[model samples]
Target: MIDKVIITGVSGFVGQNISRYLSECSFDTEMVSLRNSDWKSNLDGIAILHLAGKAHDTKNVSEGSEYFKVNTELTKELFNYFLESNIRDFFYFSSVKAVADEVPEVLFEAVLGNPKSPYGKSKLQGEEYILSKQIPQGKRFFIIRPCMIHGPGNKGNLNLLYNLVNKRIPYPLSAFCNERSFLGIDNLNFLIKEMLQNKNIPSGVYNFSDDEFLSTNELVQIISLVLDRKNNSIAVPKSIINGIAKIGDFVKLPLNSETVQKLTENYRVSNQKIKAAIGIKKLPYTAQQGLEKTIKSFIK
Candidate 1:
């Protein structure tokens, strides 16, 4: 029966939505500074939600060590305080990137691999540190690794897809078809409520994702339907698209090798562990349904 909650990083895209949800649910929510130099009065009989961390910079512009300074070091400090406090609930938001860069098959909880980016490595470091700590009988700790989370107010790669469809521009990378998983903010909120209410849910690493995987082609169709337009994407040859992406990388165009890979990748994540722990067979929203809501928000 967790009531009082303290959340860090309440200013982030995901954090803002989470704060609103908690308030509507009648939970006494408090926002804390991630840059707090002292943790003396921060923990009192309340649930702690650690969401402050350096996000992944897609443009490859941020300093590599900054990820460790915030994501790793800050997490270690706050988690240590949580263990000593009277708080019984602690939730750490991690990412699927902590496991692998490319998930050719289904991503599970215990798959070990080398992370390609500093962001993923820093998150993994935080996860390792949390797992090493010992928890008392009543206290609970959760390490959640969510997939590509998107919904209203998400101005990331999904916005790029919306722009292309809204303008009737040709999608050059239509040749590469693959399945990618996404976690809607709606489903994430639902899971958080479950974690707070149900003390039976054990503490461990869990992946958050929607029920089904949606392909890029399906996403394009969904966006076109939402915008009342036709998808004018052409099935450009694979070799030609690769060459174009290479040239774009050198010329600093919109389509680069890394962006191309992100747009068309086979990263499928399985949510069996999370659903099992939550005692459900399906998430609250399907992949296409969640994407439809996100597209509507874009037009709003």
Candidate 2:
């Protein structure tokens, strides 16, 4: 078993949770910031969890170059450093966005990556850069592409739904039926634990997500369940909603085209390969169970 692990981007939501989880699992963790100049000197761990990167900007305000600089270039730098270091295992937290912004069918590991947004393109570049390099003997690498992750303190699209439900506002896009996969923080931590302990798992790209997918309608119901309130959803016509979304594209309306697509999209990701490699049949938390935990945390 690895005695210690190094994690980057410790200030972010995923990094913080992973650090706490690893501590709970009796593994010492050290946080290093890539923004700092001397970060390379502090690499003292058996494994390096590369969690630092430029996050996808929902508002579309951030510069595209920023994504390449932080997501792509920084990853290359750290990965090169890892190649030279004594660390045996390196894990990069890539996003499913690296594969596709819109999944027509179930997304598997072998799907060709065709990212649209700058964020997705940058993440894909990071993955490609790592894979292009040749690793020395006795070293392993992992590129994990996780779907929408939710947990306590994560403020994203999920928070938007939660706030809408909390305020008794009816979900407007229920008519546009779609299902999306979600990655529970606990499930992610569980996978990391399995990978760290088990030596048989191969080095490659893997999708990290819950076994089941959930629709926005079901998600509203989940929020209602956690709040102990009545579920109120409105099936607004898709045409009307899309019209408003187009208007929102120009205007600063809450129901923009981007938000609309995010709320209602078919993005089912399969985790079979990772599970088979890790030798696990099931994750510790179910979809409903994990969603409920996240909703309850929002309430508190």
Candidate 3:
């Protein structure tokens, strides 16, 4: 049984969620920022869950170097500190973007990773640095690559879809057939607890996601069910939808081409390895149930 843990990036979304979840599990957690300050005093015989670093800016306004400075360099700094300490497990939170930006098929950790964005590249750099090191005896390292995460606190793109459904607006891109995977925050919490306790789980790269994949169309239907509204998805043609999304670019409309691709993209991630490592066939919650819970949070 794990006794204590030191977590960085305690204020961010995942950080806040995991901190609270771990506290509920009755584990003592020390929260800290991933700055250049000396954080050794807090590292005395505690596990490390490094969740700090700049997140991807969907607006695309951030500089490329900023990703490296925060995601890559800061990770290296904190990891070096972890290596010097007696921390038993070091969990580095990475993204599926580090493996592949356009996942045309189900993505696994063993595949050739070719991330497209600067954010993905920087995260890949961090993973490589962590793997390049020689871990001390009796210490385990986990490089976690999770897909898009959502829950009550998430007000990202998913919320926009929920809003359209809630307001009874016609969803235009219903015709586009696609499959994407989303990770519920509760399932993520469960995975962390398993990783912390199961010493049988080895140290290496692991991809995290829900057991099943859901398309944007299915997502719309789920929202409609949760809101108890008549489904209003219009089967607009792909050409027309693309044309409107193109116009959205100059007019700054919500359903722009980029967002349309995100909504209709095929980015399915496989969670087989993590489950096998933890000795589980299925997660605690199904994709639909977790999504329904999140949709309810929107109403609250």
Candidate 4:
């Protein structure tokens, strides 16, 4: 029964897709980009989805402070403003890294948070700011912690893998066995829609991901199929890949240390909380299906 929705970071990948999805669902939507809009007016009778934040840039360590400034400080400013406004519901997008850099054997709601990077610390700070506020009557807050999200128009490391597979490039990390969960943009859209309408969902932190997980080799296989190419995978030793990454780092090549870690690391996030909240056992799309759809979009 939500009437109007306000989405921040409208120009970014997730923001754009979420905004478009909401519009198609017949909700009155207002798009707001941090660079273009001023939030002086009180937003009465509306739900606000805040997605604007400094994203992680693996190549540049100097930008870490900026991430804290925007993700933490800007979030504090916005929360203060919301306290004065009449907005009924607020949704904040955070990352799984805020909780842990490497997924442990078990990831639960009570796990200790020890963020390794400034980006993770900033997002954790934002979540803390919201939770510290005194709950007001008729107002609800949601802090969503999503794992690596992929879909059409995604520009993260997932895209690099897709492009490499599309060009029939041989993947050298086939020997490394790693499992990771990826969130599909479409499933996220569906979850948001449910959150806006369902009054029974309690205000709290929630984790989101595809119901199933996939290993790196399986992911590459999906990409190869989408590109209509025979899978070109090599079982290179992990030590050799690490040595090449070190060399690449010294030479300032595209495949640096960070990229190497990302390709071989296993970061599996749990989505049990989100499923319980939405009363669903599975998401709308499977991990492989969603990944194939994303890879196909890169072909054009």
Steric collisions counted per model? 0, 0, 0, 0
**How would you encode candidate 4's per-residue C-alpha lDDT over 1-300 as one tens digit per residue?**
658898878888999999889989988888766564566565545688999999876655656789889899888887777777888788989888899988846455556678998899999999999999996888889999888888888847787887777777898889988888888899889999989988888999888788887898998888887788899999988888888889998998777788877887888878888789889888899888888787777877
For residues 177-258, could you state the per-residue lDDT of candidate 3 as single tens digits? Answer: 9998889999999999999988888999999999999999999999999899988999899999899999999999987889
Estimated TM-score for each candidate: 0.97, 0.96, 0.96, 0.94
Poorly placed runs, candidate 4 (over 4 Å): 35-37
Candidate 4 C-alpha error for residue 221, in Å = 0.4
Error at 127, model 3, angstroms:
0.3
Please give the RMSD of candidate 1 to the true structure: 1.4
How displaced is residue 74 in candidate 1, in Å?
Answer: 0.4
Worst 10-residue stretch by lDDT in candidate 3? 36-45
Candidate 3 overall lDDT versus native: 0.90
Q: Give the total clashing residue pairs for model 3.
A: 0
Cα error, candidate 4, residue 110 (Å) = 2.8
Question: Which runs of model 3 end up more than 4 angstroms from their true locations?
Answer: none
Candidate 1 lDDT, 1-300, residue by residue in tens: 548888899999888888899888888788888676664574575588889999989877999999999999999998988887888899999899999999989999999846999999999999999999889879999998999999999956798888998888977777889999988899999899889888999999999899998889888889999999988888999898899889998999888788889999999999999889989988888888888898899999
Candidate 2 lDDT (Cα, whole model)? 0.91
Off by over 4 Å in 2: none
